[model samples]
Target: MKEKYPNLHRMALDYLSVPATSTAVERVFSQGRQLLHFTRNRLSGNSVRAFLCLGSWMRHDVVSPEDLIAIIRQKRKRPSE
Candidate 1:
């Protein structure tokens, strides 16, 4: 029916693309909470976001330690900073 009702078909596809479970989201929150506890509670929002993204990627094996090191090195500030 996609040809007959393209908008409806697109909407259905979009709806189906969303996750059916909250497990992944809950896991991220759990990890973030642990990371932000106690001494780390002062972390800024941007720092928290970066840590979450990097932690999630590392946990999922999406990027290796060497890759992370390379990324850090590439972004290192010059002496002028």
Candidate 2:
């Protein structure tokens, strides 16, 4: 296929590589949208990423609420240099 029609083959590869459904991605985006809407633009990019990751982790039982609180406290106590 590549040898016969390089351009079409490249185009097909590009188009076919995309996912059939963006449900998971859209779900995450929706979550982020809700989060940002609540926070009202107070969060930075890094903070948003951290919050999203933490939310996903908590949802999956990878981190508990207590653990998250402890981690936040520990970070706050660390002196910035």
Taking all chains together, each candidate's TM-score versus the true structure is 0.58, 0.61
- Collision pairs in model 2: none
Residue pairs in collision within model 1? none
RMSD of each: 8.8, 11.9
lDDT of 2 by residue, 1-81 (tens): 789976456555543555568996798799999899965798899998778776866665656899879988999999997
- Kindly report which residue stretches of model 2 are placed more than 4 angstroms away from their true locations once superposed: 1-20, 78-81
Q: Which portions of model 1 miss their true places by more than 4 Å?
A: 1-18, 73-77
**What C-alpha lDDT, on a 0 to 100 scale, does residue 4 get in candidate 1?**
92
- C-alpha positional error of residue 79 in candidate 2 after TM-score superposition, expressed in Å: 4.8
Can you give the lDDT of residue 18 in candidate 2?
A: 55
